[model samples]
Target: MVTSSILVLFLLGLTAAAVLAAASKVLHVKEDPRIAKVEGCFPGANCGGCGYPGCSAAAAAIVKGDAAPEICVAGGAEIAENIAAIMGTEVSFKEPKVAQNICTGGSRANLLFDYEGVEDCRAEALLYGGEKSCGIGCIGMGTCVKVCSFDAIRLNADGLPIVDMNACRSCGKCAEVCPTGAIRVSGMTMDLLHLNKVDDCLAPCMQKCPAQIDVRTYIQQMKQGDMRGALLTMKERNPLPLAVGRLCPAPCETICRRNIADEGVAIHTLHRFVADWEMNSGSRVRLDCNPPSGHRVAVIGGGPAGLSCAYFLRRIGHEPVIFEKRESLGGMMKGIIPEYRLPEKVVEWEIQTILDLGVDVRNGVEFGRDVTLESLEKEGFEAVFMATGAWKVPGLGIENDDAEGVVDAVTFLDEVGESIDALSGKRIVVVGDTNTAMDVARSAARLGADVSALISCIQRKMSANKNEVKRAAELGSDLKFLTEPVRVIAEDGVVKGVEYRELQYDDPKKATGTPKPVEGTETVLDADMVVIATNRLVDVDALKDQNGEPLFEMDKKTGGIKADKTTLQTSIPHVFAGGEAHTGRNIIIQAVADGRRAARAIHHYVTEGEIPEPKNPQLRVIPESILKNMQVVYNIPRIRVPEISVEERRSTFKEEVKGFVEYDEARKEGSRCLRCGLTCYDAEAGAEYAADPDVSRFDESGKE
Candidate 1:
């Protein structure tokens, strides 16, 4: 019975095998052998420049009528003709093209600032716009080198990228990865003729940036709807984006490339959007550092430079403790700058991030008095960074300068900035054409004071930023330019008015060619109070040694510590100075730059115990050749930044620059960026590698 069961099971298995073999032959859809023959003719580059997935897929698609013979760019016409013969179809080829660097501007372009971030194009592009002064130039980083599947592109001696036309397959990877649009493929027709198109060079606006943030990349990130990415990029250099975004003078806009076309791009307005978005989203930058290096750095002054020093020092595994002789951390940023120009909340938010990076701030501690440099060294501090900002404003040296009701610009702004109501119902006259004078005049006017801004120079020659001049005028301040005050008139030891004379210059256009007082042009301008804004005085007395000698040599002209231009290091190897202590009262961005340099110098000294020589931040200068290669842009109107009407702004201390830009507005403004560094090239069907008719001898039907 077992033998009979086994025989039946074996016969059933045999029948099942017979049916499977028959079904395989009947149901199979055979792949055309010609498809394999056609795919073999391709160069196997698999570059998507042909608009297909790969060579194999492209081969199948061609035989099935889904793809054309001209799709393989790397293989060119020869491969197309060979594939056509295999498929028994006629073929026509589109001229093949190669990639090229469009921008000729390399080291020739002016650099906005020195870049020392990640050595990648994308990473460095996120830095204050980019290190290159030209917004659209090769960053000189080897991202294209690393990204290319074929080793075709290399950086030239001047740090600009060059693509080898012979090896480039037009994969478009380098162009896709370029942050500054410094690489691209050539046009097919142009490639056939060996004509490569080059981009125009340099965005002068980017060159004007002190912080050197890549304005182009940040805007590109924003346009792609990546708010967090934009914020992260801004934070790389500007730790206090929110504060500076509202208050900066924005020299960048003055030299904007868009100016040649129409109005300048509203850079600050777009920055405000990025800053506000980050603050609203509660986005916090995560700090990553190496293990503590067991070094302690003492940073004097909690102003921009000092704060910047502490912030950067902490990031590099050092412990930084800031000593501020104030109730709060920010020196002038918190005390003197008014809430409207830079709101109290924004100040708090921006500085708070620096403090959160493990920085220790000891308020009410004066640098030399509370903690002397000698004492700090004895207490095991590795280095000292002095950044005490200019807290005192110089007197006008006019008669009765110290009379009652006459206040220094710093002291007056400090008081009024805290309470705008303090200037109500008073007549205020500010002496000098400076940021302080403008702020004081504007603030006093906003608080219902009859205000006048006095300047010794002509209106066009005033050193103050043009925006400040315009805003003060719009706020109803009497802008009396070219009027020099000879003395402050006093009554009962209080300022009653200022005695001034109209001065005539030899050249009306020149501000500093010796002025002669016009005969009998003396006049008294009445005032209830006078605020002097002549010059900034660094508080060096606080940082002086016990014997009345300063800790560092003085600059004499700037009235600050004499330090190296790039290193920010004082004469002492272990000591560094920055901000007002080194440069007097310059721009806030300058102060930040000083602080960053001092931090690096201090770190080098602390770790290596040797002072580093000052080196200028290197940037590639755009050549005159490309500078003359101008691209004419169509008139695309710039986005207008909406502001509070004059009526509403005068009544309240609310923000006068009212509205921030939306995504659409920001994108529209960003779209106008002329990609200057784009290096695009194309390949041609060269005289060599002609189609071989000998391939027609191969059997196409497979019947042979």
Candidate 2:
């Protein structure tokens, strides 16, 4: 009976084994070996940083060709290469990106209400925008910190999460968990090309600055005694910091938060101080460039705009060749600006530093004269940037304007450059009241030319740079306000004098007018030379196409090259124009800004094949009510920039404003900055949101 039972059990076991073997063969599924190998290449943290559910899902997607090999951002380049090897495919990687918190407000952010709830940001954000006046600000409840599996983020004392750049793996976990959408995973190129948005935390000074220099960041760096860092901050936007610092009229200072109190922070002086420190340190600040992109761009005009464009182009891995008409770089900065304002040595040092970064600069190479667009394209230039400055001086509509002694500002400055001593004992009368007029008058006086009169059609208060007008007055130039030059009094084709007339305006405040000439106020002022200090127009004749046709559309109003105001692109898609060529005669800082914009536009055109339109305005200006409410009330006096005595200033061609003598002085001046932001300012400033019940959504009874 036992033997029969054992045999029966053995037969049953054999039947079950045969069934299992059949099932195994029937249910067998084919699997790609690459998927498991790709999975192995991943960190296997199951972080969900790759948009997929986990490493296994991402590996499957990568192996199946549904996703790129570089999909695993957490695993980074090593994993990408390993996956590529496993899949036997080439990997196309994106520019590496890091997560950054875009929101500037933290503890300083205006609060809607004090929250006493759960610590999770997601939970608190559900409660009427998470206690912040700005609806888009970080909730500061450590949700991003919790979601970051790599321990890359930690909350600072301000309750703001600061990402540890070294520990960050470029994963999107923290960004995904951010309730306020403040965290941004951005590429390096995008950061550099970012324009101001309405929602951005831009300061008043930053918005007002044409170059878009981060005035706050540089000032903070200065306060920290990081002179090199401050200079680099400025150079990121304005490549010619040393020159711009010396020449900028300080438009940024006019909108400074400190203006609400005693005076604006001495931004111009501090700006020059940092740049001077960099030059005086004897060691140059060198920036790292990307790998060569195998693209070449032709930049016309070696002025501020062209040099700036070349610097930025070289920085982004493209080769740029600057074709300059002059013997050296620094168009107006070197040639037109007096040596006393922007020294030639300083200009040379800054320009050489830009050229050192693999930029090919060809001096004495005129654009239309030596090279044309067709020739440049034939030479393998991918694109052309026309930055030819406004060099053409329009003729005054007076009789015999071409007299021997009658000359434009450019011609006068050029002759002065040749020999200042030649002007000795010569009588000169400079017309107009612009900054150039003041410069011309002062230069002629220094060279021993008797500056007979500095005449203007407008009132003295309406002239450019009142301080400059004051300085010119101190130098013994006769001021003639509301005086118009009717004609050039010439004898034997020589400028004998200028026929003038006195004018009165209906509105004294207005700079412009259709004045009624006083009947008996007309007079002639004797002069050996008459310098016409008027507007400079773009040399449109120089900008021509291969067929000798107008290369760019012209602005009928200004007669300047008509390009896309934002991108600076010309009628021809691949060509661009900037600086005085497009904007006529603007400030040096604005030219630098144009250069930066053109560089960005050209880069996109070459690499991406299209220039992306800006999502918002280039500059974001906060409301006056908001700005006024955000001021930090303090009566700190503006530190006066050390300058040579008027007696010493007149004797030589030296820099007028001596930069901050000591670093401590600069730091002290920097401290006067209100550190203003979009919706927030220094905490010392009285709280507008909390104090005004009408501004808050919650009732006085504390109910929303």
Candidate 3:
């Protein structure tokens, strides 16, 4: 009986082994060879940071050429490059993204009551919203820190998670585990709605602004009807919103990513609207100044740059005394900008608002004449900032150019803008093709002069903004393109006309074409007073040292101050320079940016004894899941806010562009923004489902 049973068991075992062998051959699946090669290069954390199911799934996708190697968000630039290396292709990466903790209110969070409980976030989260006044904040439990496979997160002294970017695999685990949703990705796409601060994000619009203004935030605030909040965000970086709104040639609009499909957002006009709302709504930018630092700084030039420096410095608890040679505090805006374009009331209100922030403005105190750099230092001013603008004309060495009627455009505009009686019946010929020339011509026309502009460059080469040109044309100002003025024609100091020659471009396509004067084409153009609208020279005497040399080293080529481009620091260790005095873009927004930067550098130098390395704007990548149908949010066409009619513009300079944007209009216009920043995630929901996600839904987001 035992022998028979053993033989039967052995035969059954052999039959079973044969059946299993057949099943193995039938059930096997073949994977591509490249999948293994691709998997070999992965970071191997299997965090699903690349929006994949796992390392194996991500590897398979790469081999099938379904996604770029940069799909991994946690590994940043390195992982992207390595995956690209496996495919034998050059690395193409997207913006760098890292998880960031949003709430700094860890220790500051107020508690309803204190009670002992489990140390896990999920446990605390269920007990009366995690014991904090801010209901939607980090719960301070280490559930996320405990489960981190790469050990990238830790609690700071304040009980908030500190993300170590270098080690994080962006597996979305920590965000998934956080109970109160305090931690989030910084640059989530527009569709990825955030729990708080849904508007503020690092985007190309913010990066492109020289002011680095949080544009999307303010726009979002505007959409939500938070006018005060919108204005507050603008004031964080730029002190003057009303002035910039009316006068800035917003380069921010040019780089808007939405311009790829259609017209760019009217960002400057939106600024005007927001500022006007703040002004009309009786709201002031509210901020607490730092406690007095007991340091006095001297600032020269009271324009946007100087005022901006003073404003920021004062905000940080330092005292800044601004010196202006003019009787009033307006810089370029007051000095030259016409009342029609920038109302006198606007400049006065903007500058006065800054001055109200505990700044000292000493009018008629010249930099070099009344107050020397050495004297300022001797007077207990620890640092000096020079923003004396390019206010005078450099010698052009042209024949008969020294006549009394020959004026630099800046000074001419200043005088004409203040009192038009002298230029009221004068036949004015402004020389040059740059925006400066157009400004001179327009201001002269507003003053009742018959204005004409002489340009050495051809029609297409005119440097004035097209809007300015159109307005000037409508105002009956004549534009003489490709006509070069060779000399001022005058019998005495009083100007009568200008001698000119036609110019021919050697290459029409060249950006800076070689212009040759057409010989025998010289002719005398009639005029009453000739204004040379050229790049104004910095007033060297205005910034002279006691020895009569320039206070700062001068750039021989541009004849501007030699200051470090990034730091704005001059050769003198204690001095810094910016605005038109330094060689840089002279637009109003750019000057504002310089002022803010210099103020930051000066604050650090005074407080920390060293200038901090300039930090690039922190960026975050847009997930492909959100990008695939981004059009749903970004598909709205850009709205062109109606402007004051050409008839009204020509009739009076009473603020040419329309300032009003109704609530409905603002919503439509602002909606066109691409909001190129990251959105927050429902990581708690994500992680709960992470372990055993519904397969069909899991395949859609690729979130393991």
Candidate 4:
């Protein structure tokens, strides 16, 4: 029996050895001999300094003739020569390139205005060539710093970007990203610096944008019947083109060079036309997200800022769960803007698109109540974004503000937008001179109310947009300027009349000139409803810390959240704030731009583990031609966006701007574009040169 067992064991050992040998022979991969030779000749830094997977992969590719031998900078001339000898090839020595700032002057440069508008360089540029002496000078807005994938640039005290030569990779990313073309890629030596020449007539508007979108490209595309391409070009910079096109205040118009001939080429309208066409044509602009990152982010509020932050986070493969306090999306957009100006369907479409991007929308969930920040953190949320808009209305210091029939402008507008018949046919008095008051008066008039807008400042000094104010007058709404409403007379519990005093302007030239109430010039007007269109404030108490102190605090004086201006982050590292809470009540375009910027800040904070410093922000500059044509008569009636009819609009919560253009109108409007982006390029030089690369090369070769 022992002899038989020994024989079986010996056979088993022999069979196992044969099986091992066969497996080894079948699975063994032939190692590339050239890889080791190339690696040996390399610096062996394994720094991944080259734009490749690793040193081994790069070496293998170099051996296979897939990459240039001179790619490994650390290897230097000696290593390059060695690798070349091994590969049987010669390499040409190339000059090292370093990042350089084209613009020299910084904050010391002269300014045209204070530029107290949006913080974004692009938004500021849209509002009249920015407040710089040189039209192409940097605004110090820091858009490039925000967009840098690597922390290689920073804004100095003079509002100029200081590039870290060691950190810079000469990728030309900063140059491509610079709106003003202020940041250029040149050789480490001074030889290339002399080669860099400035374009004297660069468009200031294009220089201010963060995305560096070629404004002229889309305008040319639109002129060439390539509306689809025009829209696509815009989408390359901003995914929510339609929404921005519809609501953007068009700072670009303020600095348009064509204003010298006529009103700025209705650039916003052209953008809207192409954007709407693309949407209706079923070309949805959806972002391609990375694979699931297994990380989660909780975004509070569904306003533009929160939604924008969530959208960008999802694009980076992070799971963002938006906790909206309201039942629907578009926090202030749905609540504040009337349906006529911005339709529900449009808002719904935008929100749905964001939702479709893998963002988990949890509506009707109030932050701090339904889900606390601490609770979210415990639930595995790596980061949180607080974008709750300023919802509280500022009160007028008048005595009868609390009287019946007295209403806050925001509350009244929200009610009217939600239900038009809430107080229809009632005589309404809107106090204040800003756009909100104008919008309230116009909306009330359309709702069948006898609307009267009273302004403390003179007609010329009113804060409302002149075009919108004129539209209100054309719509039969009474606009009383230089009349300040001081006392509200109440009969029993309801408001009976409003007593106003006339005022005289001290300076007729300024928009907010000094005004003095004229003695013995009091008047009374009968009204059933009085809406105070004063100011909007944020409720920071709702966002409290563990100790019950406000987690995200704002300056008591300015009401701006005490947060990093560049990162949009509050004192709390995980919490970020934006929009009305940071900038107060501003234009929709500015708000949208802020949201987009905040998204970038939040992305870096969560992933890169560092808050990027602000860099030189570009400012928009109005051309002399555009300034010459800024006559009051040059203002053409704004092309109203298409909407449902007034009759249909009043019956339900439908839109009211029923004026869509056909293909012909759209084309004509597109042609009317002054081509704001064109100013950036030397049109004379560009026209002289051919756009086709092959044709230009052929011409050059023939000349040679």
Candidate 5:
């Protein structure tokens, strides 16, 4: 038994020895001996922070002189020095950088829209660009939070990601995961500056100007020669193209980008050319109304808003009955604008076109007097739109305002339109510094009146468009800046001059309120007639409820209507109000937009019994190339279309500003539009590469 046990033990030991020898010989890895020495000096973190696969690989490269010794960023300066000492190589050092959040704006502090959808930030970004006020701001959708493997980050109450520096190893994973360029690594000394990314491209001149002039559109259009289309486009927005083309303040030119390039485009002259073509060639615009909706609307006042409302209402199959206070249509347009700028015949032609659209005209009918709100209801009208413009002249509150020859600008313009003989040779003093004041000054100067304008604002601070002011100057009118009308001077109830004081702007950047009077700068100017061109006032008593509160009551403080800003509806569900009546005095384009919005609201109210919410109120983005290629031009001198010669202008109230471009010019302006509707595609080829798991991962061979 003893002999058998010994033989078994010897055989077991021999088998174990043979197995160990075979394993070592077959699975041998021949590594350099210096690699062991180099790796011993490392921190042994195995963090894979160095560019190589691992610390072992990094050690091998350093031993072979293939890689620099100071490659491990996580070990930093101390580890780098140790590796360099073992490698027998010297290396320069750099301070490590840390990731930072540059924007101070967070969800709790910055205004943000509620976005409910997919959990992924990429999916949310596809919808309206992630709901931030600024286009380029952080979405704070927690993308960085999810990508952090070390659990080193937490989203604050404000939805902003806060990084815990202690847990952070500078892995750079959060920066790669952020969809927006919100996360960035920088030196400790770096100071971040916030950037504004709101799109201000479609503001002021581009959107607010009447005639939908697409001042940019026509500049590019006229540069190309699609004159007929350009003319048609102009007529689409303004029915009285010839009149607006001739006398609009050209607000677009005042804010023209080309003004920085030396001069502004001649937008008004191009408009005049197209308008004259359509009018002279007997190419009248025809209307196509839908089948009757069995709804009838009553529009009070025949001014721009009223006419525009009537035109649109008729197009949508509703019958519009316009009630004008005067014997003719075109309320303010007919009563206030001089014939030298807008001829009665042009107004007649435009009104005739609206009438052709089946609009019922009830001339010589005044609202609140000849007609009442109850009367319209009794007449079977489904809706009533009150556009009675602020025709009442505002009081200056100065003494002797009731004296003779102290006329309101509206009344003076009305007399000029009527060709009254009283304004032939009188010396006129026009007050205020708006487009209306400029119009009055130019009209009075052309009428042989020695005109002088008294503006409370400085010459450089005039609110009127620069072109209009220049035109007034060219007409030989005297302009007195920083002048305030204290009182009207008179002798025996007859006007003699204006008692005034010079004023100055205290704050140029925030100079919106009343002016500050200069001490001991009181002055008086000699005048035979005084025309007060102050702002107009609106009376909303007619728009009241049974409780005597405004029926369409808006917030008295903010001046914003109580209804939704997008829908433009009033407090009353069935009624909506817009234009100057709701928004005080605004530009023609804003008034037109208000009318259009109100019409849409009324249509929705009548059909759906509720106001429709806007699908998306954000501006659509087109490709940069599309915007760059869009051809916009300005040809006229940014001045009102030239009127009859200075001599002829003073003689009779003839339409001024003759000479328009040919069909070729109009066509060219039409072709310059980039259309602003094309979609942009992603430009990066590697954008889709990150989505593929196989392509994103590194293989055993270290090749991806």
Candidate 6:
């Protein structure tokens, strides 16, 4: 019976084997031979840096043409070459990347509660946004260090991860494991392009400054005795550092961290000192630019905006030609600004430095009279930048404003430097209470004009620049408040006096009151000339085409070229406007910043045919409440900036603010900086996370 059973089982096994071999022959599929070759070329690390599951998946994708040979980041150039050889294709190279830690606040960061949870960062982050006060800061748990297969990252004494660039394969594993996104893998493009995001760390001074100069870095360079390095750093954002250093009102000083204790650092003076150092040493710092792109751009108006636009355009390999209506560059800066404030030699030097970068200049070339938009297009210019200044004088709301001896402040300042003798022993009455009016009154007094009075429709406190008003008064100009001009009394189309009336406000208690003209207060002030200090408008006629059609759309409110505030692009697709052309009478720093942004926009539009979206779309806003909470222990006093005496300032056109007397003095002032960042200050300023008895610790339930 056993022999019969064994015979049946053997026969069944033979039948089963026969069926399996037949099925295998019918259902078999073939695999690509190149997949194995590609897989063999991989580093076999399976780091997932290629966005695939493993080497086998990456190899299959490469074979199918879904992925490029250079997708294997760990394998690098050698492996990519080998894979390309096997796949019978050329390798497309990509920018190499390295890991960087975005958060610098480690031990200096504030805390919410003591963390006694699990050792892992991922676990600790589950309770109440981690222990650090900054939600986006590093968790200080070394999860990134553990996942780094190449041993490129290690935890420092401050519990922050430090990346070793040499061993880093750009695998992005550390960035992947990081819970708070503090660790990131960035490439060359990411480093060069600065776009603010919600998670970005920014200092208060950086956010306030229109140019966004790296205040902390430049001051640190100054402290380290790197005067040249500091100037170069300033030149990266602001092309006219020397002019800005002397003339900027310094809005950055208002929000400085040192203001919490004593006073803000002398940022403007430091900037001037570094810039003067470069000038005195007779060395100019011009960065290496890209090869010429063979594209020509016409920049109209040789002002701050035009110079800045040309500088950046040249830096990015595009040829820029500047067209100026006046004989010299620096629209208002060279024409209007008194030599006492910003010297002519400094302005000349600043403009010359920009010209040395291969930028072409055509003086006495008016935009409307000489060259139109169509003429520029016909001249093979790829793009046009309208960086015109606020030259058009607005109406004075008074009759006979067009008469002789009645000149606008812009025209007066422009002609004052060349023809100071024309105003000798003349009676001058300056209207309006703006800083420009004060400048006119002061300049007229200095040039031997018997200034009748400086009149304003607004209250005394409401006038522009109190110090300027006081200076004009000290220079022998009479001050007349709450007065409005009615008409320019002229004989034979020449001014003899200015008719005016005193204004009465409804709310007399408040200084910022609504003014009404008194019924019987008309009066006339005797004068030889009336200098109206009304605001300026853009020359729209200069922006017209040959057919009398507007080349660019006009902004109704601004009475200038309309442009997107962010992109600076006008209605015309190829033409762009910035600085006083769009925004009238802005600071020099703002004009420089606008020029840079407009240049970038133009470059992107010309080259890529589209505007480049910001890499980081949002800027993190640090609350003033939190900023004031910083425990500032240092009581260091602010260093005094050296300046010429008032007597000397009135006599000659020498620069009013003499720069730092010595390098050591400038260095000592630089060291007083708080070195602030986003939620971070100098570590010496007592850490905000110090233990407190009143504060709650980690509860048993692990709740906040």
Which predicted model would earn the best lDDT?
2
lDDT of 4 at 463: 67
RMSD of 6: 6.7
Flag regions of model 1 displaced more than 4 Å: 1-203, 417-424, 510-514, 611-616, 619-629, 678-704
On residues 5-35, what C-alpha lDDT tens digit does candidate 1 reach at each position? 9999999999999999999999999998878
What lDDT tens digits, residue by residue, belong to model 2 across residues 1-704?
Answer: 99999999999999999999999999988888888888998887888877888999988898778999998777777778878888888877367778887666788877878899888888887766688776667789888998888899998888878988878877888888777777878765666566666656677888888888888888988887787778878887878888888888889988887665556888888888888888888889877666668889999999999998998888878899999998988998886888888898999999989988889989999887799888899999999999999978877788978999888888777666685455777889888767788889888888777885545466444446777777778888887887778889999999898888887777766755666677798898888999888678898778766667887789887677889988899998999999888888778888898988999999999999999988867454667414553334333445677888778876787888788898877876787776666665664432323343332232333233
Candidate 4 minimal-lDDT segment of 10 residues: 188-197
Q: For candidate 3, write residues 1-704 as lDDT tens digits.
A: 99999999999999999999999899987877878877777767787766788888988888888888877655556767877888877775243445676554565545678848888888877766678655666778878898787888999886878999887766778888877666665432111111123223345566567787878778878877888878877887788899999777787787665564445777888888888886776656675565567989999989899998898888767899999988998777885777677888788878878888899989998776788877888999988898888877665578888887887787777776354444577798888776778888877777678988878777666767777777777788888777878888888676888888888778756736658888999888778888887567777776666667766788887678898876789999789999888863377888888888788778777767887664442332222213222122123445566777766665576877766558777766776665444322111111222233221122223322
Q: Which tens-of-lDDT digit does each residue in 337-445 have in candidate 4?
A: 7665676667777787778888998989987788997899899987777778777777777768788989888888778745555556688899988778877887887
User: Candidate 4: which stretches are off by over 4 Å?
Assistant: 1-57, 60-202, 207-214, 225-228, 236-239, 417-425, 508-513, 545-548, 619-660, 668-704
- Cα-lDDT of candidate 2: 0.80
**Reference-based lDDT, residue 630, model 5:** 16
TM-scores for every candidate against the unseen true structure: 0.69, 0.89, 0.68, 0.67, 0.61, 0.79
- Clashes per prediction? 26, 0, 8, 18, 27, 2
Model 5 over residues 1-704: C-alpha lDDT tens digits? 99999999999999999998999899888987779988887767665545577788888988888888776645666777877887677866343456655333454222457788876666677775777654444577788778765676777875667777766656566776666656665432121111112232232234436433445444444455555656545544555566666656676655443343224455666777766666777766554466667787788778777787777677666777998888988866675776655677777877787788788999998777677667887988877766666665677789999899888888877786455454566788999887778889988877678888988886667777676787688778888887888999999999999988888667856766678888888788888989888676566565555567765666564343344566666665655556666665555555555555566666666656776565533323222312221122222222233345655655555665565445444443333222221111111212223353422332334233
Give the root-mean-square deviation of each candidate in angstroms.
20.6, 6.1, 19.8, 16.6, 23.9, 6.7
Error of 3 at 292 (Å): 1.1
Q: Model 4: how far is 458 from its true place, Å?
A: 2.7
The TM-score that candidate 2 achieves is 0.89
lDDT at position 401, candidate 6: 84
What is the Å distance of residue 670 in model 1 from its true position? 1.4
